[model samples]
Target: MKILVIVPAFNEEEGLVKVAEQFHGINDVDVLIINDCSKDATSEVGRKLGFNVIDLPCNLGIGGAVQTGYKYAYDNGYDIAIQVDGDGQHNPAYIKDLIKPIKEGRADLVIGSRYLKKEGFQSTFLRRVGINYFSNLIYLLQKKRITDPTSGFRACNRRVIELFSARYPNDYPEPESIVYLLRNNYKTEEVPVVMNERFGGESSINSFKSIYYMIKVTLAIVIDNMRKIGLT
Candidate 1:
């Protein structure tokens, strides 16, 4: 199967080379860096290093960046697409493990989760609380238990690629997209994976942003669920 590793980068010049180097020698898997209008030299670095990169004209947030990659994957006839964050938090070592279920045709999407085996760098205290809140919220809404609803590290098959390319949520998307898949009857599974601390660059979401993220995502999921039930 044709596999595409979509790395969404935003001001991640510090870790670009390291990220690129890790994906090297993975045969038959092409790596595409979606440079989301980074203010730094992210695009230039990718080009200078000879990596396939797509430079968005403007900042489109993580969802838009990822959707762009999906569009590329769909248009290029790729069968599987995997997202590896450019912040250097996602390890390339588990790429095969994340893609295994989808490759076997047993799953439509696979989420690389940190809570499955309780192994890896679980985030800060408040972040864990937020993750727990969303976990309970998803279970309450869909009865599906997602240990890591906010994880960006994931792999999806062609169907999901086409759907996401056509229409994907913007802004904070990790949690809401899971609801989208579940509502659409797609099989989403999670596998235990290790997360490394950010190798470079700061996270976009800080304390205030996390609060805003919680409120925004909660409302989005509610409205989406309502729409699914013809309530809106």
Candidate 2:
């Protein structure tokens, strides 16, 4: 199966270089960097490294940047598309493991979970609290246990690529997209993988943004669940 690694970058030139290094000479895998109109040298760095780069005319946040990758994957006929953050938190070493269930047809979406093994960089206490909150919320709504619902490290097959290309949430998409897939009866699974601290660049989410993220994602999940229930 043809695989594409979609890295949604925003001013990640420093970290992106390290992330790109892991993909070097990996056979049967292609990398695409979606430069989200970063003020930094992300685009130039991607071009310099010879990876496929798509520069959005304006900043569209992570959701829009990732959707752009899905569209590219669908149009280019990729069998699997994996989302690895440009911040260098996600490890490329686990890319094969991530795509395994998808390639075997066991799942349509596979999330690389940091909590399953409970190893590596386990995020901050407050952040883990938020992640667990979403996990429970999703289970309450869908009865499925997604250990790390907010994990951006995930892989999806062609079907999901097409679906996301056509319609994806605009913000905090990882958890919400899982709910959408489950509500519609798509198979989703999680695997044990280790995540690392960012190689460079500050996180977009601060204390203030963390509070907003929690509220916004919670509302998004509830509303999506209600909409799905209404449709059913």
Candidate 3:
């Protein structure tokens, strides 16, 4: 199977080199770095690392960056595509586990969950609470247990690629994507994985931004879900 590892980057120069190198050695995996018009040298670093770099002319948020990757995967005829954060948060070792379910045809979408096995770097209380709340909301909507809905480290097959490429959320689409998959009768599962702290740079979401993000994303989830159910 042709597996493309899509790394969406934005001002992540400090970690991009290491991130690209780590995944380069993986078998049957081709790395594609989508440079989201980062102010840093993210694109140069990725190019130096010899990754298939897609440089965006302007800054697209995380969601836009990720959707660009999905589009490439679809257009390039890749059998599977995996989303890995440009930040140092996602571990590359757990990628095999994430791909297993899809290879077995047991799942079409696989997410790497930090809270699954009680292992990994614990998130801040506020972040954890927000993740859990959204996860539960997804569960309630799909009638299936989802431990992590906002995990960026995930794998999706061709079907999912086609679906997401056609219509994906613009801002913080993770939770809403779960509903999309579930409603389309696609299988989604989470794999246990560890996450590392950011090596450099501050998170884009601060305390105030976090609260605003939560409200905005929650409303998007509701509206998207309602549209899916033909209740709009």
Query: How many steric clashes does model 1 contain?
Result: 0
Model 3 bad stretches (over 4 Å):
none
lDDT of all predictions: 0.90, 0.91, 0.85
Please give the ranking of all candidate structures by lDDT, highest first, separated by commas.
2, 1, 3
lDDT for position 153 in model 2 = 96
Q: Write the per-residue lDDT of candidate 3 for residues 1-232, one digit (tens) a residue.
A: 8889888888888887668656756767888999989888888888887888999999888888889999999999999999988877887888889999999999999999988886867788888988899988887777888888888889999999988778888777788788878877899999899888776555667788878888998887777778777999
TM-score of 1: 0.96
1 versus 2: better lDDT goes to: 2
**For model 1, how does the per-residue alpha-carbon lDDT over 1-232 read when each residue is reduced to its tens digit?**
9999899999999888778777777677888999999999999998887779999999999999999999999999999999988978889899889999998988999999999988879988888999999999999999999999988899999999999999888877889999988987999999999997787877777899899999999999999989878999
Prediction-by-prediction clash tally: 0, 0, 0
Colliding pairs, model 3: none
Q: Which regions of candidate 1 are displaced past 4 Å?
A: none
Colliding residue pairs in candidate 2: none
Q: lDDT of candidate 1?
A: 0.90
RMSD of each: 1.1, 1.3, 1.4
Best by lDDT: 2
Better of 2 and 3 by lDDT: 2
